[model samples]
Each structure stands twice: as C-alpha cells, then as structure tokens.
Target: MKKRLIYGWLLAGVTFASSCTKNFDEVNTDPYKATSENFNPNFLMSQAQIQFSQTGYDQLLFQSMWVQSLASTFDYYANGDKYVLRGSGTGYYSRTWNRGYGALTLVDEMKNLVQGKTQYSNLDACGTILRVMFIQRITDLHGDVPYSQEGQAKSGNVAPVFDKQQDIYKAMLSQLDAATAALDLNKDKPSSDLFYGGDISKWKRLGYSLMLKAAMRLTKVDAATAKTYAEKAYAAGTMTSVADNAKVLTDNANGNSNSNSDALLVADDFREVRWGKTLIDIMKTSNDPRISAVAEVSAGTGKAANEDRATPGVNTASLQIGMPNGYDLNGGATDISKAPNYPGTSPANPAVPNDAPAPVGKYSRPRLTVYDDRSGVNMLYTYGESELLLAEAAVRGWNTGSAATHYANALAADIRSLAQMNATPQAVVSDNDIASYVSRNPLNTANTTALQQINTEYYVVTSTTFNFNETFANWRRSGYPVLTPVTYPGQYITGSIPRRMPYPITLPQTNGANYQAAVANQGPDNFATRVWWDKQ
Candidate 1:
C-alpha cells in the first residue's frame, strides 16, 4: 500500500505523451504503466492528501514561531522568531502559495477524472473537501489569492485574478456543505484513501467538521454567516471522537517521511528549535498534562549531546523550561544568555573538538522520540479542533452543545492525540492523567474568559501537533494567550506581530495586474495586513 501510494505521488507529477505515428498508437501505450484513462483516480486523491498535508518548511519558518509554539535563536528561523527576513526568508514567503496551488491542481485533475461518475462519486466529494480545506489555508496565509480560476493555467488562463477573501470563504462553505451532503456510504470507497481507508461516513464527518472550521473563520467578520453554518455543521454532524481524526501516517520506507520531522532533524534546527516559553508557561500554569508529553530537556551537557537525535531526553514537566523568542547566540545584549531566567549554558567537553558551551541547551526541545520520527502521523484535522470549535460556538450562544462538555472533551482529545505522534503508546500521557487535567481545568463560566481559555487550549493542541498554520490563524482570530510582539534589532514588520504573509516575491512579474489589484483591494500585501475574516 505504501509503495503504491508513493507510485501515485510520482505518477501525479508526470505528463503523458503520445506518439505521432498513427499506426503505432497501440504499441506506444505501455500496458504495465497507468495512464489518465486507465489509472485509478483514487490515487490522485491520495497524492493530493499527502502533498497538501505535508507542510514542511512552509509553516516552520513563519507560523510555528509566529504563534510562539516553537522558538529558535537560530538565524535561519529569524524570519519568524525576530520578524526578520534571513536565509531563504524571501523564498519561504512563497512556499505556502506555490505548494498549496500545486496540490490543488492535483485535486482539479482528480475531480476532472471522477466527476459525474457513479463509482467515483465518493472520491470526487472527498477531493472537494480536500480542495476547500487547502484553499482556505492558502487564502488565510496570503490574503486574496487566486481561487475562482485557480489551477486553470493549463486551460490558457495562467493569469487568474485574485478573488476576494470574503467570496472565497462563502464558496468554501457552500462547497463543504454540498460535498458533505453528497458523500454516499454505499458508493465505492477510494482504494488509496490516506485518512480513513475510504470510509464514506468518516469522510462525511470530516467534511462537516471542515464546514464547522470554515464557518468559525468568518465569526469576526460575518457573524450571521458564521452562526448559520456553525449550526448547520453541528446539526449535520462533526467528528464525534478521536477515532474520527483526519490524519495520514507517513511511510519512511517508501521515502515519504514526515516533513516536520525532516525539518527538525536538520542540524541547525535540531540544536536551536525549542518549545517556546509562551506555550510551555501556559501549560505549566494550567498544569496541563500535555506539557510532559510534548516537551523534554536535553540529556547531557555540550552541543554534541544536545544535538544528538539518538538519545532520548528527560520529559519531566518541571525540568522542561521553554526558550524565549527573539534571542540569539550573537554574544551581545540580545543574546539568550542575557534573557531573564536563562538556563545557563551546558558544560563544554574538552574531549569534543570545537565544542563550546551549548547556549540555550537547558531549555526544552520537542521530545525527539515522539516528534522527530520519520514515519510519524501528520495530523491534518483532529476531533479536538472540532470539539473546541463547537465549544467556542456554544459560548457565542450558538446551538452546538454545552461549552464545558465540549471544552473538556477537546482537552482529552488533545492529550490523546499525542499518542498518535509517537510509535510507542506507552510514552504518551495516560487516560487517568488526561481525565484529572480536564477535571481540574473545567471551562471558566464568564464568556470572555471562556473564549480566551478555549482558544488558548486550541493554540496548545494545534501547536504541539505541528499544525502551526492553524495555531497562528486561531491566535489572530481569537486573540487568546495574548502574546507580546518580539522587539528585535532590524526586524521586518513595524513593531507588531505579523497578521499575513506577503504575496510571493515573484507575483509582480508573473501576475502583475491582478497582484496590484489584489493589493489595492486587500490593502498592502504585507504582514500587518489581515485577511478578510481577521477583523479588528
């Protein structure tokens, strides 16, 4: 199955060509290899799911640190930690846009093959859900992106105009609703379904859950639409438990390793990236059980020990200190050593060549065994997210369920989701621990406080799962776990947390007219500018 999925990924990228000789048409076609006409469209859906969900450096360089879920003093991460453009920063700005559209193109091809075909009905619906989920991410990151005519370049419409974010949200909601309604359990299931093994019922839950998510994105900008769809999504049904989580298990044997793990394993990233103080402090303050599950302190002294991926770290919650953002090892005023409560540098080993005291070594990095697994699960969406969204909706007086019940459920689901990140189940938080934590931290009754608590937990859950894009988006929308903007020398933004990533640097040359128009309508294409739903 893994090999076949890998083949699908490879095949998705190829463009088939035919021989000019009319008499040799039959001979030209390879019987062993699959072509569009004879290929399984489900493979396209599988490829789309993997490509869209594997958000490697795309989110790592920005969203991860923007939300202060993970922090780094590494210069490469300065683009996010210090709000400054460093190495590959300019290129990173375009990753989400380019990769997202590329995946959407696969979905478009899949839809083209499967649409209106009875046997492919479920595949088409699943593809639509995948398409909307990804398009939402693209527009959320780079506001007013090409949507209406997206992926139509092969049809000679290469310069598709950027659609209004408002219209895009509406269309996404409508498509999600229709797709959820269209899923038929009796129809054929996609053979290469990465999420649920082509269970149409689960796909229906995911579609409606996505509807709930898309609806919630409109809460600040358009409350009426938000309420209507949130209610509809709830009524239609969302993920009922962790069993309904939408995730894909990576296959390292097939060269499809977890992208987050690959990025973290990079030597520079391995040594510097730590769970941020903002996130760890919140968990510690709340006595959140997940703190120990998600974080760990390096096992020994010196740079070599800290960067060693083979040795497991201690995950005692008390020892897990988070590194603050916007500090570096530049040996100056802004050095991490100068920060308050800075864990002193690890001892330098005389035996190790060129080994200096490992700066920021005492601070917590993501538990290597759990998070750095090449074949770890990539969480696309979770039952925790669905429940939390419902909890927020309930707080706003929408008919979802009891705010406390949903909040508690979400908390438990979030903790349980950690087990999925690791290969060994014994390394995860226990059910007793999860239950106790949920009991101790029931939803605060006051509406505003409740909102803060819910979204803050949402931030923790998504961040720990490495769903950094969603973490950043929800933080922007809910204004929870309020973060102070990092003030670093030579920063990019104007003394504020960035709200949106700028358009790809090449947009002016590739699609100048539409790019200019989008900038005009959506405000300047910069970090300070918010997307349509991110109303102040």
Candidate 2:
C-alpha cells in the first residue's frame, strides 16, 4: 500500500509529452508504473497527509526560536533568533513557501479526481480539510498569497493573482463548512488514510476544530464573525478529549521517523538549544509539574561529582534552568548562569573566555528522549487547544461551555498529552499531579486578568508541545505573557518582535505583476507589516 502511494506521488509530478510519436506502442509504456490517468485517489491522499505533516513540523524548526520557546546557541540561527531577515538567498522562506504550495497541488489533484463521484465524496471532503490546513499556514506567514488561482499552472495560469487575507479566510471557512457537512457515513473510507484511518466522524471533528481555530484567528479584526463561527463550530462537534487529537503517528523506520527527532540528531551542535527563560520561569513560579516532563537537568561541570550525567541530561525539575534570548553564544553563557534565582546544577563563570565554547549543556534543554524519540507522534490539533479556545469563546460571550470548566479541562488535557507523548518513566504525570495542578491554578474571575491568565496558560501549553506557530499567533492576537522585545546588535526589526515573514524572493521574477500588487496592498513585503487578522 505504501509503495503504491509512493508510485502515485512520483507519477503526479510527471508531465507527459503532449504529442505522441508514430513509434509509440505497448513496449514504450511501463505496465507496473502508475500514471495520472490510473492513479488512486487514496494514494494521493496518503502522500498529501505525509507532506502536510512535514510542512507543519518544519515550521517549528525556526518559529519556535522566534517565540522564545527555544534559544539557539549556534551562529546559523543567531540572526533568525534576533528577528533578522536572512535575505532572498536564504532558503528558509522559499523552502517553506514551496512545501506549502507543493502539498496544495497534490491536494488539488486529489480533489479533482474524487469530486462529483459519490463513492469518493468523503475522500474529497478530506482533501478540502487538508487544503484549508495548508493554505492557512501560508497566509499566516505571508499575507495576500496566490489563493484563488493557485495550482492552475497546467491550465496556462502561471501567474495567479494574490487574494486578500480576509477573502482567503472567508473562502476557507465556507469550504470547511461544506466539506464537514458533506461527510457521509455510508461512503467507503480509504484504508491508507494517515490521520484518521478513513474515519468520517474523526474527520468531521477535525474539520470543526480547524474551523474553531480559524475563527479565533479573527478575534482581533472581526469579533462578530469570530463569535458566529465559534458557536457554529461547537455545535458541529469539536475535539473534546486527547483521544480525538488530530495527529500523524510515526514509527522508528528509516523513512517514517519523526522529523523533530531526525533534525535533533543531525543538528550542528547537539546542545545548541535550551529551554527559554520565559517558559521555565513561568512554570517554576506556578509550580507547574509539566516542567519536569518537558525539560532535563543541566549537565554543567559545576555539578556535584555524584550527579547523574545522562545523555539527555538528568530529570530533576528543580535543577533545570532556561537560557535567555537575544544574547550571543559567549554572552548568553555568561549572563544566564548569573541571573537571579538561577537553578542549574552547575553555575558557570560570570565572564567566560571569549574563545570558550558555548555553555549550552550547562542549562536545561528539552527532554531529549521524548522530543528526539523516533516513534513520537506529530500533533496537528489537540483536545487541549479545542478546550482553551472554548474558554476564550465563553469569555467572548459565545455559546460554548463554561469558561471555568473548559479552562480546567484544557490544563488536564495538556498534562495528559505530555505524559502520553513521552512514555519515559521519569517524565510520567500521575493523576494526583494533574489534580493538584488544576486545583492550584483555577481560572480567575476578574475580567481584567482573565484573558491574560488564559493566554499565559496557552503560552505554557504551546511551549511544552513545541506548537510555536500557534503560540506566536496567539501572543500577537491576545497580547498576553507580556514578553519584552529583544534589541540585539545587527537585529533587523529593532525595539519590537517581528509580526510576519517576508515573501520569497522568487515571487517578483515568477509572478511580477501579481507580486507587485500584493506588496502594494499588504504593506511593504517586510517582517514589520501585520496580517489582516493582526489588526492594530
């Protein structure tokens, strides 16, 4: 089945010659190879799912640094950490853009193949859900993208016009509504489905959850629409527990391993990353037990001789400390160890030698065994996120459940999710721990601080799960956690954090007119410009 999926994917990229030769005969064609005419929609769907997972996971590699969930000690990401644009020559922006649009093409093909066919209506609905997921990420990163006419290159529409972010959002919401409603239980399901295993109910829940997410993104710009969709989503049935989470399960096989684990193993410096101070300090002050589940104790030389020096570091919660953002390797190494309430097992010199190696391992890093585990699951949407959004919806006077109940459920779900993802004995979060944490952190009734508290908890939840894209977007929308802007030397956007990534450089060359229009409509193609949803 997997081999067929791969063959179909390969064939999807093939462009056969329009004119056939007189010599064309049976011997000229390969009988076993799949082609566009004979490709299975199920195989195409499977490939799309895998590519979508890869695209989403890759965003964390850099966006996590932007949100301060993880600090980079390596020079390669120093400029990115400080919000500096690496220029058109840098592949980060272009690579992400290509991956998103590439996946959309596969999805478009799958939808075209299955549409108007009753037997494949459910599969077509899945394609719609996948389309929304991919396009949303693109518009979020680079406002005013080629949406309405995208994936029409074969039809001679190479330079597709860019659509406004508002229009894109509206269209996506409508498509999701129709797609979820079109799901029929009587239809045949694809056995090769990667996310829900061809289960229509799970896909329906995911569609509603995605709709809720889209609605929340509009809170800053269009509260009325946000409220309307939020209510509809709840009624449509959103994810309510960890069991309903939309994730792509991966194995330890060579080509199927988790992307995060693969990247960690191949990173230039094994310890280039450490827990960010913003996250660790919040966890410590609140006595959050999930902190131990996420981080490992420092392995600095200053620790006691008998201290455990495990490969991923020790699992002592009290001994974990996070690295602060904005400083260079040497500066961070010296400054972090001297900060007030430093909790690392080892304390480094207040001033280290200029030539000394970065003291990254001296500070706490993410629990390696779990984050770098080959068989880990890649979460797309979670019950915790759904509950948190419900809490926000209630606060907004929407017809969701009680804010307090949703808040508590969100916390419990987050804790359970952490333990479930990482089965290490030391990282376990027992029922007692969840109960104690929930009891200690009840929702505040004061309206003034209620939103702040809710979003702050969201920041912590996203940090632990490495869901930095949503974390950054939420921070922009709610303005919670009150993070200080970094003002490092050579920074591109000074005095404030970046709001959006610039468009890829190839845009002007390939689609000049449309690109110019988009740039003119959406402020200068720069990081400082805000998207439509991020209203001032």
lDDT of each: 0.89, 0.77
Badly placed stretches (over 4 Å) of model 1 are 1-24, 27-34, 350-354
User: How do the residues 277-365 of candidate 1 rate in per-residue lDDT, one tens digit apiece?
Assistant: 99999999988888878888888889888888889988989899988999998999999999999879988778889877898889999
- How does each model score on TM-score? 0.94, 0.87
Cα lDDT tens digits for candidate 2, 109-153: 888887677778888888899999889888888889988999999
Check candidate 1 and list the clashing pairs. Answer: none
lDDT of 2: 0.77
The clash numbers for all candidates, in the given order, read: 0, 0
Top TM-score model: 1
